[model samples]
Target chain A: MPYIKIDVTREGVTREQKQKLIAGVTDLITEVLDKDPKLTHVVIQEIELDDWGYAGEQVSVLREKGITAKKQ
Target chain B: MPYIKIDVTREGVTREQKQKLIAGVTDLITEVLDKDPKLTHVVIQEIELDDWGYAGEQVSVLREKGITAKKQ
Candidate 1:
């Protein structure tokens, strides 16, 4: 089983959306990686923009540069 | 179910060690967080020193500074 952690901005996403994302990603992983769905484990971390920094740059900085990063 | 993902260096750790760590962490989470062990889902990510970077610095850099950061 592959464990997947998803970090996302939870501001605008609905609870249903979050659930859907988890289910969809789990399904994709099972299909693409040939793993069992029952063995799948997915973790979701909803953090504000400031919580996750990359390459010494805040996510806002990347957004300002027009570089969009998907959270998953 | 609460999903927990562990990111650790796997170089010197044995498979048994990894499994032990997962079980220990899961136990700790359950005890401290009052979560259910049966519902607990843990994922372990073993990444090379280069794949993960933080604060514009590599893990090696942090190790050099002697400010050891624990991976989870």
Candidate 2:
């Protein structure tokens, strides 16, 4: 069995979006690995900003300092 | 940055157990890949029995049929 897990920063995730991800990821795994969909598993996790850290600081902290927050 | 994800069939998971998993996995990744824990991300997903299938049947169905139900 091929198990696939996807993790994303939780900010603005909607139910419909997650549903689409589940479907798309399943299909991609099946195509790439030639694995049976019946035996494949796909899981998605939405993580809080504070729990995720980058550059030695949590994302929440980085956003507060305006280090990586902006508009183009 | 290294991202680690773990997926398991949800049965009787407890909060304390998941915390241990997060810590242990982070340590393992750091030791193996030489990545900083600050930049390492670990996510755990507990899946429902219905959503996970094996041997061409859902785990719930197998349990119902008394195929893999146990006392061993």
On DockQ, the leading prediction is 2
TM-score of each: 0.40, 0.51
Candidate number with greatest lDDT: 2
Per-residue lDDT tens digits for candidate 1, residues B1-72, read 688877764346688987898899889989899998988888887754332333323344446687565665
Consecutive 10-residue window with the lowest summed lDDT within model 1 chain A: A9-18
- Model 2: per-residue lDDT, tens digit, B1-72? 887667777777665566666677777778888987877766666778899899899988887787664468
Chain A of candidate 1 compared with the true chain A, TM-score: 0.65
Question: Per-residue alpha-carbon lDDT of model 2 for A1-72, expressed as tens digits?
Answer: 988777777878899998899899889988998889899888887776555545344565566787653456
DockQ of each: 0.03, 0.13
User: Share of real interface contacts recovered by each model?
Assistant: 0.00, 0.17
Clashing pairs in 1: B7-B72
* Model 2 residue pairs with clashes: none
**Alpha carbon lDDT of residue A1, candidate 2?**
92
